[model samples]
Target: MNKLFLVPLMLLPSLAFAFPIDVTKKLNGAEIVYNTTTISSNMAAINIQNVGGTAAQCRVVFVNGPENPRVRNTVVQSGSSSYVTANFNRAVIRLRITLTCNPT
Candidate 1:
């Protein structure tokens, strides 16, 4: 019926606005950095950096938002690099970060 169709149509915008882009990177012996200039409604971008001489690994987990949380990982090889530019919703989010470094 028309009412049924209308229900789905109304949800389209909200559904479309829920998901964000995933990003990843790798770096070493310095800081890995990411930046964003713009974000839409319920949307945000995440930046990651590594600042050390040894290879490093990191992960980011989002706890709250319009959509479910997600995890992103990066591995920086020795004297190399890794990084990520992630997109997410701005819904009372929490981040769980982990880092590991290899012995030089």
Candidate 2:
């Protein structure tokens, strides 16, 4: 009975590690804030925020993750945000994200 309790405790540490990505970059006089949260071992939620005062446009791409091989794209507008969800078949060690934006 004690061993059963120990198994869940041991697994807690691995589950505690979640991917939360917050990347900020300047592109064409605008600020792009990219955010991603790991909902589970094989899933993630993505978002992009435009904090600049001027109007801007951006294209966000998510690629190279386990279970999810196809690229996902999101479009964001100035002073607004966009969100997307990505799914994977298994646990992912890493993910690649790309952002392209321009000021209008």
Q: In lDDT terms, which candidate is top?
A: 2
Candidate 2 lDDT, tens digit per residue, 1-104? 99999999999877875764443344666777766788776677767787877666665555544444445554556679877677766665676656667877
Candidate 2's TM-score reads 0.62
> Best candidate, TM-score-wise?
2
What tens-digit string does per-residue lDDT give for candidate 1 at 1-104? 89988998898866554343433333333355544322444444455444555555665554343556556666765555445434444542333332333333
The all-Cα superposition gives candidate 2 an RMSD in Å to the true structure of 4.0
Clashes per candidate (backbone, < 3 Å):
10, 0
Candidate 1 weakest ten by summed lDDT: 92-101
lDDT of each: 0.47, 0.66
- Native-to-model Cα distance after best TM-score fit, residue 102 in candidate 1, in Å: 7.7
Ten residues in a row with the worst lDDT in model 2?
64-73
Q: Sum up the clashes in candidate 2.
A: 0
